[model samples]
Target: MNRSEALSIVEPHLTKERFEHTVRVADTALTLAGLYGESQKKVEIASIFHDYAKYRPLDEMERWITTSYLPKDLLSYHHELWHGPVGSLLIDQEHGIKDEEIKSAVYCHTTGKANMSKLDMIVFVADYIEPGRDFPGLNEVRDMAEKDLLKTAWMVSRNTINYLIHKQTSIYPDTFHAYNDLTKQLYGGN
Candidate 1:
């Protein structure tokens, strides 16, 4: 779908602040797509729908996880992490967006998994580095983004883990997988 269509579909599902955040993420993802040679169309679609399920009720998200093929392990994690996986499924079910790349990008946007595609990295990093966000290590990740996408994603992964650990929340396994995979890709380690 086109940008306007995608935005319209997602806007009602999100809070006003989140809709604005989605727009920033779309703009940020497009910038990364331009730099990394990814398809701008895919980046835009993925970014627009990245938070499609963010405002879903906890019980509804839990039901989607249990009934759909989404990983059951998500139920054990904080409800905050459910949006990405639920959003991934809902986009296809509700909006007819069946693109696997877009689905995967949305699936792991919050806690990235191993073997991320260029499109996935674009959306993942774009969500984290979007201008409205303010995290401890955000500036450095934003700077690295223009220079190198992989390293920037790795930093985002690292920073996310660190922040979660500081808050003493349960860190999802896919998050660590993202960090480890990026580290291996960055430093040539197994």
Candidate 2:
């Protein structure tokens, strides 16, 4: 579907602020796609739908988690990371987006997994560095994103882990795995 169609599907599922943020992320993902020579259509689709389940009722998200057969242990982590993976399933089943690449990019956007695709990196970093986002050290992350998307992805992965640790919250295993793989690539260690 086109941008408006995609947004229309998700618009009722998000708050006004989140809808605006989603649009910014889609725009940023398109920019990154242009910069990194990835598929703009896939990136845009994934970006717009990345948080499709973000505002779902907790019970609804839990039901999706179980029905989709995602790791039950996900329940233990903060709910902030649930939307990406759950939204993947929601978009595919409810919105007719079956392309595995787009689904995977949406799935990996929150707490990136190991072996992310170029499209995945674009959605992931765009979600983090979207112009509507503001956080400590955001400028540095945004700068890193502009310079190198993959390295910026690794930076976001590492930074997310640090943030979770600082908050004394559980860090998802996929996040640590991504951090290790990206670190090995960026720092040259096995």
Candidate 3:
């Protein structure tokens, strides 16, 4: 589906505030994609659907997990990271989005994984730095997004790890892998 059609499908599921945030993320992703020479269409689609499953009731998310046969690691990280994969499932089953890049972007937007695609990075960082987000260090991330996409992604991965650590939450292993992989790529395997 196209961007407008995808947005329509997700709009009813999100609160008005969240819908607005999605729009902001789409715009941000497009801008960042242009700067990074990534596919703007993929960035737009990924950003639009990044949070599609975020507003589902906790019980419904759990139900999806139970019935979808999602991996055990996902269940282990459910409290923190279930939404992304669940969102991917919802998009596929409900929205008929069969594109691998789109599905992968939605699947990994939360608790990013190793060897992320360009669209994945765009969606992940766009969600984090969207206009509605007001966290410390966001400015640095925004600047990095404008100047260097890989650098911005690496910073976001580090920030996510730090936040999880500070909260004393169990860090998802995929997040650590993502950080390591991106850091190595940005540093030329150093």
| TM-score list, all predictions | 0.98, 0.96, 0.93
Query: Taking the tens digit of each residue's C-alpha lDDT, what string does model 2 give over 33-117?
Result: 9989998889889999999998888888888887777788888888887888888888888978999999999888888988888
What residue runs in model 1 are displaced by over 4 Å at the alpha carbon? Answer: none
After superposition of all CA atoms, the RMSD between model 3 and the true structure is 1.6
Which runs of model 3 end up more than 4 angstroms from their true locations? 188-190
Candidate 2, which segments miss by more than 4 Å at Cα? none
Model 2 pairs in collision: none
Quantify all predictions' global Cα lDDT against the true fold. Answer: 0.95, 0.89, 0.86
Q: After superposition, how far is residue 157 of candidate 3 from its true place, in Å?
A: 0.6
Candidate 3 per-residue lDDT over residues 86-186, each given as its tens digit: 89888888878888898899998887889998888888889899888998999999888888777888999999999889989888888999999998897
Q: Best by TM-score, which number? A: 1
